[model samples]
Target: MSRIILLIAKFSAFMLFVAQVESNCPSKCDCNPYSWDMNQIDLDCHRAQLDTIPRNVPLTTAKADFSLNKLGLDPGFQLKLDHLHDLRNLDLSANFLESTHIKDIPDSVEILDLSANSLSELSLDDLPTNIRELNLAKNGIDSINGCSGESSIQSSSQIAIRFDYNAIPILTRDTFGNCSASFGYIDLSSNNLHTVEHNAFRGVIQKANDSLVIDMSYNKLEIVPFEAFQDAIFDMRGFEYFSLDLRKNPLLCSCNMSWIPMMLDYFQKMGLKGVIMGTCYGPEESAGRHLEELTKAEFKSCTEYSWLKAEIKARTEQRIMPFWQVCLVVLACPGLVATVVLIVGVRMHVKDYRRYRDYVVRKKRQIATQRRRHHFRASGAVGDVLLNSSIKNSQK
Candidate 1:
């Protein structure tokens, strides 16, 4: 009988603990078992017409879905989720978040869905560095904030960034400069992209084991800039999965379109996969034609006059210098040589003349000294003869 009472008390204590967990769950949110074991709870408040995150989102929530709601993000609204440190997934998509200047996003969130929002701008401060998959699709974003060489989106893990369906006109190298993260894939398709500047994919491409997929289809692309690949396309040896989707674009077919076949030939030789060579949509005669089908002769006609001009220009560049200029240079060479030779000869003559003048001065001094010595000796001999005559006269 004592054993039965003890068992009854333990059952009552277990019920009290379960009641406390249930009370922690929000009243409006439909909290359900996370799995068959019922060990955790998954809070789902999707389409709940929530103006703000539930004031009491249970700290035990693993995944929170707040999508398809009328939540407007601004500086005034507090979006703090400090309590939910283990929250891995946060879905706030389709919420009329015009401004992405959000704060207090849980650092633990790996997948953040901000798609279908009214976001017009994005910056480093607007997102968390720990985010692995960021969805900014179907927004009014016109430009991406450059990193100014600070940090990249690439962290210890692979990151996938989606920017499809935006008003981006030109994609310069600095567009993704801040995305220091090696990207899994960067979807820029369906944007009003008219120009992709040289090496536009510079910092975004991950140099990891998995290949990077860049989607630029269904846009206003006329030419695939050669510099965009940074010449890495030639050495696609080790990449596990490298693919480029450039279909549905209004590519202008011209002589420059020759590069399309060259790239296709390269992909075939290397056994690389996932290359969709889009067709040409211009030059009236070659519209709706695939880039691979068009031969060199067919492409050259697009710029018929350009060939003649190019040939002439090439011939002109290869041509020798003008006859008069050649003659002038030749003549000037000899004149320069003659001038140098004349200067050297004049210097030698001046040196020799100075030496001769010094020699003549020395010879004149020696001759003058010899005449004085001879005069002295002759006078001394005459004085000796007179002295002898005076002595002989005194003796007589």
Candidate 2:
């Protein structure tokens, strides 16, 4: 009888205390106590036709889904989520938010989604300290706010950032200079990215400190800027599971893409642990082919010209290269033949001069021999005639 009385009193306290907690919930939002976390609530105000966030949400809200709303249309809609100490994940995607001047988001919120909006500029000053993953896809963002040294963004841990499907046309070295996060995952895919200048990710790609994954797929790149990624490849070589996805880019696959094969070979030699996906999409012969799988004959045209005439002929072969080499030789042929002919003529003249000198010496020796023979014959005849005259006088 005493135990039953005690149980009735405890039940009445629970009904009055715990059950009345739902009475303060917003009319448009559903408030449910999360089973995983004690006393924490999950607020679902998504697609509730709300022009602003409900102010009556419980302070113990752990997760909030405020997506698909008209929050940006209201000028007086001031977002203040720092009061919710237990908030972690917040989905504000598709809200048509334009500015990132939000200053009240708490550090407790880690995953923030601002995708499918009209955000033209993103500032690092708007993010939370404990944020791990931030989605800014399809925002048509033209520039980053903190990159001009207006402010600095510091994060306690490595963050994964997504800026995919935006209006970014070029990436310079100072693109992400304001964000001091050692970001492990960066998705810059699906944009008007035509060029990534050298050292574009200078601060972003840490030096052998952490693993990284970069997605630059589906862009308007005609050349694979090898100079821009030299440091990135060196930094990623020590990592275990990194990836550089350049697939679906409209690469020219000409000498312009000559760095593709060299990068693959170096990636093999360095023992870098990752997969690189790149393919050519134009010039007909190299379309739909992997960058590393192309033959030396395909890249043979790169060696054909003197680096200046590379654009003379598209996909010229080794046969064409030799023709230019032969032309160079033909241009030098007259001077080479003249030099050789002059040397040969000089040698022949020297040989004829030596033969003439030997002939003159032989003619002098022959003339002296004929004179000695003539004098000896004349003396012999005179001696015989005198001997006959003396013998006739002695006989008389």
Candidate 3:
């Protein structure tokens, strides 16, 4: 009988300890039992207007929703979540906080929602390896630290990332290169995207399966460089469930875009899914025209309007000279004539001078020859006189 009383006292103490732990839930937060086990709970403190993480959060919580709260970089704010060893989904979105606070988030979390925050960047360390869904939409991020597809975010077998409505201005080459994991969906829509370099989505397409879905609509894109998708298209050639949404973007249509028709044909032959053709909104002639409906004559052999204008200008130049050019030619005619006349006159004068010099030289040569002939005659006469004088003296 004494042993039974001791057992009852011990059970009462254990029950009291559990009751105290349950009562430690944060104030103004709803904590519901997650399972039949009273020790596991789910905390929902969303929009709680709390400036700091509640100190009384139970360590047994499996999912925490502190979204829409005033959680900033306050001291130990993330420490509060780190204590929940079993946390799976953490929603800290709409908090207007930077993502730096969650750089070292618990690896137990699989779904992390940092959307609608003030994050300007996301480093590889900011992502947990086991994460399956990472929502960073509606942030101020201009670029992801390691979006070349080798980052920790893509280390998982399957993950969905929402990066829409960010401040990304461009997608460079190999932005998603060499990724090996399959993504369910990747959203880069509604950003400030202006240029997507060739091979920008290479790594993304390399790892994606047939069920890949990508949204890139509602941006400032003028064109989608087909070279960027060339390899991706080949990789997804036989994929019947591939989908790429590029609607509502202001893509210009011109000769450079002649490959669109070819791309559509390839997609049809491969039985690829999703919207493969979009409407053009530029090149005035092709504007308000769908890529699918554009005939080869209508869309092909098409040049930019600026190029057409230049061609017309060139043709006109070949036909008629501009007023300025005509004036310049008219003004230069007299000068040309005068230059030719001056050159002719100078040549004639130089010819005359040379002729005169040759005449003077010939006259000097003639005079010198005449003087030599006279000297030769006088020397011959003197020699003859000397010979006769010697003969007469000998006779005397």
Using lDDT as the measure, the top candidate is 2
lDDT of 1 by residue, 269-340 (tens): 445663646788887888998766765455444453354334334434444466689899999999999999
The worst-scoring run of ten residues by lDDT in candidate 2 lies at 310-319
Query: Tens digit of lDDT per residue, candidate 2, span 1-396?
Result: 999998898778655545655787788887776633266777888999888777787888888998998877766667767689889888889886776534567788888888987788777767776788899999878766444554444555667989999988887765655456667888989988888877676556554657778899989878766556655555554566667788888887887667566555544545556566888887798888887686545676575223423422322332245577888999899999999999999999999999999999878766765555555566697755654554454445
C-alpha lDDT score of every prediction, in listed order = 0.70, 0.72, 0.72
For candidate 3, which ten residues in a row score worst on lDDT?
A: 303-312
Best by TM-score: 2
State the lDDT of candidate 3 residue by residue for 1-396, as single tens digits: 999998898778667655665577788888776644445677889978988888878888878898887777554555356677788788989886776776667878889899988888776446765787889999998976544444555344556889999999988776656455556578989999888888776655543344567788888888886766666655664464656677788988776676666555545544566355567898898888886775445554455333433543564455567889999999999999999999999999999999999999878766765555555557688755754554454445
> Any residue pairs clashing in model 1, and if so which?
152-180, 153-179, 153-180, 153-181, 154-181
Q: Candidate 2 regions off by >4 Å?
A: 1-21, 35-38, 145-157, 207-209, 282-285, 295-396
Query: How many pairs collide in each candidate, listed in order?
Result: 5, 0, 1
- Tell me the lDDT of candidate 3: 0.72
Distance (Å) between predicted and true CA of 321, model 1? 43
Which residue pairs in model 3 clash with each other? 176-203
Candidate 1 vs candidate 3: the lDDT winner is 3
